[model samples]
Target: MSAEPPVSLRELRARAEEVVTPEAWEYLETGAGAEVSLGEAESAWQRWRFRPYVLRDVAQISTSCRLLGHDLATPVLVAPTAYHEPYHPTAELGTAEGVRDAGSLLCLSTRSSRTVERVAEYAGPWWLQVYVMTDRDITEAMVDRAVAAGASALVLTGDTPYVSRRARGTALPLQDEVALVNVQQHLAGRTWSSLEQDPRVTYADIEWLASRSGLPVLVKGVLRADEARACVAAGAAGVVVSNHGARQLDRVVPTALALPEVARAVADQVPVLVDGGIRSGHDVATALALGADAVLVGRPTMHALATGGAPGVTAMLRALTAQLAEAMGLLGISSLGGFDRSLVEDVTHARG
Candidate 1:
């Protein structure tokens, strides 16, 4: 524990409401559609229970794990979310520093308020998440920028071809007020944006994107075994099990519900990571135990940012790591690898 008393992720959340505009907080917290999907993801997390072991020396526990071929001090990776400047002036730069300080990787979004290079300048083991534009030229340019920015991996988020309407979350009237600054170059100083594409992007585009990228590419938003296999065959170096934070598509299965099949499909060919509804360090353990190589966390981190900016983010991440270590100790586990599918017994039917 730090010399300072530990604060719950909840305390940070309340701080976020006070610090950020009501509208921005709402936007950061809400999910799209009827929100049944978001509810499912959270509920899915509850069905998992860690079967603890007895009489083992696990006093000094570690949650360090490797992701995209790099070691993360914890299984946590900061999920890429755009427009972080809405809460703080430093934007992704501050988030990157917090991620580094927490010994984790930061995955940045293409829609980031900070340029990918600007972000990479302060980054620690970061990856870039891309949204393949419908226009091939724009897509190519985005890939080039990520490479130029020193991103170690290219993650094409295949989900969300359109904007999600997160009803419960608050947002600034200026939420639409924030322009896509980096992509603004594509507009060529023109008043019109013919280059912009619809949100209905697809896997075929992901395959095309992989062919175009110079760096190792990973496909985000894989929810099925077949999609996972297809991504590998299409030359993706890795895949993320996600549901766009349940911000897209209603009534879909939680990421965890589908993790095993995708993990088996990807097998050892490449690493498989998962995101959506991760709340605690134990959730990270549960993800690894369910076959996810690492976990991506977004909203809760945003909640921290809304609450305390850089300092709160650092605290939130550190607390989760400590919780993860505690969970590992209770399970008589030491190393991150000690978590495997054997650690989780699916209690869904029992939950019913």
Candidate 2:
């Protein structure tokens, strides 16, 4: 646990550094190739300075938000991540508990150490994030399992259609501890010779998974405006414009830059959310004001958890939630509906 009192996410991140492996730390911290985009994501967040308006009655404040029919205490959802056990033995379950207790949503990853069914046993207003495999059977089966396990939402990641080529720290060895349970049965007869055939995404993958899931399915990893339109037309309830946190492709536009176009393209056809370098509650406010219905967060939470475990994650959320409320109160936003395009003025020559 962190000896220092955590007043905000920054404190949680500093504490997380003490417990995380150097290799895993780099894995979470690094961006694609030369890491220019990674820096840009940070720069993007920093560039968007807030215009605060004081002298309002903020006696009553609410951070409540709804995604796919589930109301969140805060719009902050736990972005999908794999193998929490590496950071804490309780792994994704601990993450679920944190999200549940925090009154936010936990989106369990397809690659999670805990099976979807097992993770579902924890209290949730949760979503299951799935990787669409080339094999229709596997995709269909994963959807079936997620549905049976009582998952309320399905997030299909479209960004990571292939393995990432970026350079990062050494991959933490999860072979001995973490196993992918949902696809394990289908992988039994799969051989190295057939490995090329095992990618978890295909046209049939989308069509098949949607056929089985009665819940809302969100397509993640979208960047281009045309692709955003396609995802909605293909029946996505929402789109999460992301470049896999700059982990997949280097030099891609920062997640925030790509969001406005995609959000415009979708045009209420579906809600749009984005993720890449979001770090704070003001970042969340800025994202909403620009166009996103919500935003996703990844590495920061892990950074916090790696530093402080449950308390670290708890403190991080508490600070972000408080900061978000403060941002809103300062912005004179009595509710989310009040945030609009006029609220955000794009800074020229500023990092996007």
lDDT of 2 by residue, 1-352 (tens): 1123325555666777778777667666776788788778867866566655567666677878877788777777778986777787777777777777778777788878777887887747888888765555666777788888888878888777676766764576677336555567666666533323345464445555666898888888888899887777777888888888787778888877877788888947777888877777788888888788777778877876676666656666666777777778879886676677666766764445
Candidate 2 Cα RMSD (Å): 3.5
TM-score of each: 0.90, 0.90
The lDDT leader among the candidates is: 1
Which pairs, if any, clash in model 2?
A: 15-307, 16-307, 132-200, 132-201, 133-200
* lDDT over C-alpha atoms for residue 99 of model 1: 88
Give candidate 2's TM-score: 0.90
CA lDDT for candidate 2: 0.74
